[model samples]
Target: MGGRFGSPLFGASIKGFLNDRSALEGITSFGSFGIGITGLYEYHLYLPGVPGLRPFLGGGAHVATGRASAYNPYADSQFSDIYAGLDGVTGVEYVFEDIPLALSIDVLPVLNFPGRIGLWWNAGVSVRYVFK
Candidate 1:
């Protein structure tokens, strides 16, 4: 019951983001690279006898930052914008003891200041390392 079920977790990941609005007009695209780091606490909730899958929930904070540059032909100006946001995440994960790794994907909509609603999507993989 305590093999891969009892431990504190930590990980880092790189993601691509599609900002709804940017400095340019008629052009909204996903990021080339948006990197982030995370720290999390996970707890197992399923019974020991369950052979199917183990479910767990985690909560954590993530930081993402990126820069965008675009050329506006009409305005004849090059605009560069830097974007950064902090997000709070809560999601479920599935652990399969048959394999040595656990895979998880979570929707971490963020609250970014200086923007409307500031809801951004963040989803990625988390490699788990269990400790006794």
Candidate 2:
């Protein structure tokens, strides 16, 4: 679910997470999973032409689906009914001068829409090889 798109300015990825109900809750017996995709643009930040730490800003979209059931004092359920959201990201990347390999870390703020309005932050790290 991760790979570079042959360009330093642009990259794409898809990711997912899973959790078991026993781990999530002490009573319920259901599992859940979520998936999302993102595209990023890395701006060539200024540092006297240094290619070590290039900071960038970009945005993309995401879609996630999952549900968890609760059964302790009463029966209840929660779902990521939002389904989709817009993502804003800011990050810094470093490319090895002798090779086409790059590594980066980013923080993303998400805005979910429609009936399930919510905001959250996501942070990640990525490594890529430019095929230029």
How far residue 118's Cα lies from its native spot in candidate 2, in Å, is: 0.9
Q: Model 2 compared with the native: what TM-score?
A: 0.61
Predicted candidate 2 versus true structure: per-residue lDDT over 1-132, tens digit per residue: 334322112234532212211110000111233334444333345456785666766676755444433311111236443256677877776768888777767777777654447675666566665443
lDDT of each: 0.37, 0.48
Each candidate structure's TM-score, on Cα atoms with residue i matched to residue i, is 0.46, 0.61
TM-score for candidate 1, please give it: 0.46
Clashing pairs in 1: none
Best by lDDT: 2
lDDT of 1 by residue, 1-132 (tens): 111111111234322112311111010123343333443444445556765344444444444333332211111123333334445554445556666444555545454443323555555445453321
**lDDT accuracy of residue 88 in candidate 2:** 80
